[model samples]
Target: MDKAKVLETRRLLAFIAVFEEGSFTAAAARMGMAQPALSIAISKLEAQLGTPLLIREPRGVKATAAGLLLSQRAYEIIGLIESTVEEVATVEQHPTGEVAIGLPSSTAAVLAIPLVERLAKTYPGIRLRLVESFSGYLWDWLLNGHIDIAVVFNQASRPEIISTPFAWEKMHLIGKALPGEANAPIEAGQLTGLPMVMPSRKQSFRDTIEHHIQKQGGTLDVQIEIDAGHQLIKLICSGRFYSILSPGSVAHEISTGQLQARPLAQPLERAICLAQRRLRHQATAVRCVTDELLSEARALIVAGVWDARIEAPLCT
Candidate 1:
């Protein structure tokens, strides 16, 4: 057989395993092969490809620069192969499969807890993988086929993804109730020059807030720009700095007296949107799970689980 033809799928898979597990011995155990046999196979693969794929280190083996590049391509190849197998198997079996959900860290903090629990109970066969990232990264991942779906705030310029409104929530200015400060609504301009902790400029919420401030003839003096919702809430509670967030995120803290939430004057609100790739194929189970999410979200809205002002935008 030709040398290239001798490079079997099994060898490629073994190479990938070693690249991931970082050791020939561990890869052998993972692949159910003797350590020496796995090492021989790796050697054969490197010889066939005419390149060293891994770098031996004292702690563990690391992929070489070439190896790292190959590993990325290997991942995509493996994913496509697995997806094909799963599609064929689904035709014979039921629509049970995995769904990878990408969410912003803030959305995951507020919504994923209950959503995951419900999904686990209702669809035990459907494996759900949640990736928490910022809106930009999540959007990129969604387009790149790294995730199956996402729940995020709608962006002004829509990407080439199919999106549906999942829920709506009012944005609130949360801060420690300062000594003797009136418990009344405060104007957005009043927050100007305050040492507020805000989300990074890339986040949709921060962009909207900044636009609103500028439109009202004021500028925000952001002392901190954090991406993690829990961290922001903790900072607010610790009296270090104040931040703005959707009411849904800070509801628990507000109810428990850990933090105080006030509606911004001339309030802003945004819709939570569910997004999936426009051209990618979605497994039936994933679609069903999304449907369940929408149903539960609607039920939460009806039961007043979300705050009252979150129903629609205060502006329109």
Candidate 2:
């Protein structure tokens, strides 16, 4: 096969419609085209590839093995084209380009909405792409240029990355309140025997919690090491286990009495840092988002809702 040969977008779309609908007649109807025209398009595409892409059955059409491979590539190519067109059309007077940001799941719960709202109002032309994951993956994404910015935890300075201290967040022991239990702070030592569900070890937040637990001369009886944030919260809320998490992550549940959070008597705080690849060009759109992110985080801290202390101000 000639790798350099161009695959016409229209023909690819026609083939995809048939592949999904599984019948030329239905696909042509869905595409608002005649069945014969749709069949000709698919035939031309298969001829170009020099292989049979579809096998006609008594009931409908089924794709050959080669057809399956082309369908996957076709979707990707089409999606990229559509997104590129939309991005180009959005350019105007203000800074305009896609700015990809990475965030931990805990932080995303509190910050994603406000950040999107602020950018839409202040920099309407800027297209924001948010990626939610743990800090370790965020760091890797930043270095790999998969993301332009990331809100990470306790990151040290590296040659390829620049990190600025943004805030420090307090960790709390989250679980359902025991019968008639008071709302006082819980001792770190008490966690030694509790059934717990925690994030896996590679994550920075998990590492921070384990470090403090070991420091307090206690060990966590971890029942499950799950990375999915929502499910972990669910298990804790069901009164089956407890997990140490930042307040922002479980704020709604705590307010509704679905879960109760106790502050650690010996406080454990994690440094929240904003990081970027030092070598990546600081485009106007990216810089605008960076400033807005710092501003929004500062506001959250000052509002007294996020249970955090500002370590670096936006002006810095």
Candidate 3:
């Protein structure tokens, strides 16, 4: 590349840092340069463009209208450069790197083990790191680039994220059954006064459940709040409280007859989403592990182990 072109690219990066941070000192520190040097670079950039890109203010600086347009274009240019470099580096690659994935506790309970096994067997060079939390945390991690991939529930629209529908799981009423009692579907109205063990308010699925119940003129009498899915299930199994969960969440207990699950008369379902950062470059290792995850989920759904309907086919 030409020397002038290289300097222009550097100036663009400097402008982006200052524009986002809104402070020359912070942007200078972020770029590992002296504050004076960063300011001079920005001045030179403005002079070259024949316009003022930013206005100095008491707090720091604010972008001019022209500056905003340049910042947006700069991001596109930088993103394209980064993705191009990563793609070229992966040519003839054996995918030897770590890929971090986030999953909600409910999905991780069943999907984690199989995903690990498949990756180890098929792509030994690819190391897998799993972070388990609720869907809300998982969404944050995915957007902030803390994780390469995530399995979330009913993800909302966001420009930074690219999510695909994985499945739709039907919610059920789960609790310990009385002796000689037959498990039957429960009416939505019947949950009005049910003493339920529920997830914390921060959890997205908790809001989904609340919305459904409230829509039916029912309110949950929550006796306990537990964030961890496994612990919540344990509390429910003690025969002290009931919870609304998907069959997949309590598949083991349901199979062993330790806990019985009753479907709702009017089905309530939640979407399982596979999410990733929209602008981040997808490396070979990341793509390989994502494929393995999709395959494992498909196999589980097909074998009737996870009681969910596939919303879309796996990505190739």
Per-residue lDDT of 187-257 in model 3, one digit per residue for the tens? 77888777899888887778878888888877889989888888999988999889998888888889998
lDDT of each: 0.71, 0.81, 0.81
| TM-score rank order | 3, 2, 1
* Ranking of all candidate structures by their lDDT, best first: 2, 3, 1
Tens digits of per-residue lDDT for model 2 on 1-316? 4564558888887887787678999899878999999989888888888999999999999889898888767766765665455446654556787889998888888888999999999999789999998788888888665898999888986534678788988888888863224567777788888999998887866877887888888778999998777888899989999999998888778878898888887888888999975433245677789999999988987997677888643341
Q: In every candidate, how many clashes are there?
A: 0, 0, 0
Instruction: Indicate the residue-level lDDT of 49 in model 1.
Output: 82
Cand. 3 TM to true fold: 0.78
- Which parts of model 3 are misplaced by more than 4 Å? 1-83, 178-183, 312-316
Give each model a TM-score: 0.66, 0.67, 0.78
lDDT of 1 at 301: 61
Q: What is the lDDT of residue 211 in candidate 2?
A: 77
Find the 10 residues in a row with the least total lDDT in model 1: 307-316
Question: Could you give candidate 1's per-residue lDDT for residues 130-156 as a string of tens digits?
Answer: 888877678778765688788777743
lDDT value, residue 41 of candidate 2: 89
Model 2 alpha-carbon drift over 4 Å, by segment:
1-92, 178-181, 311-316
